[model samples]
Target: MSVRAAELPSRDALQQLVRAKAGTAKVHHLVPVHPALAPLLPDGGLRPGAAYSVTGGALLLTLLAEPSAAGSWCGVVGVPELGAEAARSAGVALDRIALVPQPGERWLSVVAALAEVLPVVAVRPAGRVRDADAARLAARLRERSCVLLVCGDWPRVEARLAVDEARWEGLGEGHGYLSGRDVVVSVATRSTATPRHVRLVLPDATGRLSAKAPGTGPVELRAVG
Candidate 1:
């Protein structure tokens, strides 16, 4: 049998009901986009069944591979500009990732349908993502235990993670093979509590993003213009 969470007395009660109904569970470790975001999340990870907004859709899609590195199903919709090389840099295993080619109003429908099978679904909230649609999507995600990562400006999501341009001070690379060396990027996010932010040196290796350095101070990142 199934029960609506709205009817539960409280969140704790709902959790208990879910736990009892859903038998044993296995722990899945979460890889935070940055160390600064670790504490913001209850278990140093993205909470399942909620929405996380990435400031830049491209960057967000790349970073998403971190948590789902264990062969989990990931879906991206309404984004056709994704590059294979960029996907590699963001640590996504392109071979396993599904890129659904949907445009216009069909994107939202694709997102809703794909969420049933994909563990983590990322999308650009540009076309067809209305407030009512977001509400329905959130409910479906919660019911299905699918994590929805929205990459754009959407006000109805459960949480928001915004990224800004990286700050580099006194860092230089000579005109050689080291031209792309030592670049840093910073991202800031707002939650129910205080705002959280962090900066990290871009990963030297392709197809991966390093976890934030522990106890590192956050550099202020204003929105990208």
Candidate 2:
């Protein structure tokens, strides 16, 4: 197996990659994962050419939903486990998100093609994407200024965001639709700074984003015992 990316770059180089851009201008009414998260990010929204890795395919799809819901074209490459219903619930315009049934060794080429036309491109991590390939991808990403969210470990990628596993609760004796599991998904991780942790209540049946417990204080995760 190849070495982990954390092993290749020196501490200084990693730090340089993770540092937020200086002299950021303020944008009015920006949408981020949450209120607290908005200030932590320089763009005030999901940054283009950056990668956000989730624990599994479900979360990966969820992360891609927002951009798709906003009428952006999303290209999903090498993902076979995606469900139609879940994709809809996540707010991805099913019509707009193209699913490549099979993307074999042509991962980089596919990514290159999608990055030019699609606004948000999601690739399921499978094989090795070398530092050189990643460099080319990053260059193209910069040129296109499109958002690229990958679903696995990428050492060559300059920035990354890792969402922590969520805690669930508040189910009473087989109540509600799910398996009595009230999962509280975490919105945590920073690409160019220290990691941040926040709580986001899952959207309702109508695909609305809201908090389970309403309050003015810091949001906390609540789950069943």
Candidate 3:
């Protein structure tokens, strides 16, 4: 029995269905991250339509590689210190990256606009965000299914990822130039239960991130409710 084309659902109908089911994991689209860092994330990837507060400027920006590589648009606002070279080195598609070097007082507005279209938006607030503004941005992210990657302090975030005790692997006794860095990355969440940590190279000796061999490096895991 062949079904008529008219019986098929319209694009708008499909979109509405996705939005209605967005809150559930089944409907939500997850973007993959570096395998080494996957163990730290709740579902081992980036969940769209949620906000994540992360520490470490470079490490925070590096999270976009997965989505960017998957042909998604990424926007970086109010983070002048993050260089394009670093983002590229971390496997981000430079052409797909939209950068607003200094968003100043309009950082929130810029993020809101980008979230409407981009799949991922990373921001480093120049100053404190009012509760009202935060709420509005959060709502926008939910509606548009955009991932908000924050690089600084944000109140009432869905999850918080921080890199701690980072130790450089090279340049001991002022002999060699900078090489790689090992850090303890901890991820904790409030919206969903994700309590785990991992020790990995932010960038190994060859400038690529990978998990440290077990028993060869220190490990620390924090228990959370």
Candidate 4:
């Protein structure tokens, strides 16, 4: 589904429409993330109605892939550069995904609207966002039981995932093309004083995220401040 900025509805209207479509049921369970990433999250997955800040677009798509494959509707806002082919290759269900590439100044409203009905919503802020705006949206997310994935920074978030180090594989002696990337993913949450780090092939040879094999090499761990 495509949402044009000109046709975007008010938060109230969107909430009503969502209620009509999905009723008042609240999802209290955690949404599934890729197995390779589960260890980084305190809940072992994404908690419903919570917001998370992610550093990379590939990582954001990876977060959505598992939930989308589990039959959840996912939405992307203000990310015109998101490639559908890449999303699909990352294991996201294209058929069940909605794209709002340009929400303009109303990106927050667009996100809040999508969060009401979509189980997973990913967005890249078009500009600086106020803490008040983020707080309001947080309330909406809680009410709707939606999981928000912010590509950029947010005033408040349950957790933050970042790629501290990355190395592309499949380029040997400058003869082969790049096939995959080994990244050190770091997760910081309010509950932990220190961020947890894990190494994985963000997009393995098959274009899927997977844990790096044991004894592959030493993984460098760094603190994220």
- The top-ranked prediction according to TM-score is 4
Model 4: lDDT to the true structure: 0.86
Question: How many backbone clashes are present in model 4?
Answer: 0
TM-score of each: 0.68, 0.67, 0.80, 0.81
| lDDT, model 1 | 0.61
lDDT digits (tens) for residues 99-157 of candidate 3? 99988888889999999999889998889888888888888987888889998877767
In model 4, which runs have C-alpha deviations exceeding 4 angstroms? Answer: 1-28, 214-225
Better of 2 and 3 by lDDT: 3
Tell how far residue 34 is off in model 1, in angstroms. Answer: 6.6
By lDDT, the better pick of 2 and 4 is 4
Give the lowest summed-lDDT range of ten residues in model 1.
175-184
- Residues 142-210, model 1: lDDT tens digits: 667777787676656655665455433333343223212232233334544655554544443343444
C-alpha root-mean-square deviation, each candidate: 9.0, 10.6, 10.0, 13.7
Which residue pairs show backbone clashes in model 1? 88-207, 91-207
In model 4, which residue pairs have backbone atoms overlapping below 3 Å? none
Error of 3 at 43 (Å): 2.8
Clashing pairs in 2: 168-223, 169-223, 169-224, 170-223, 170-224
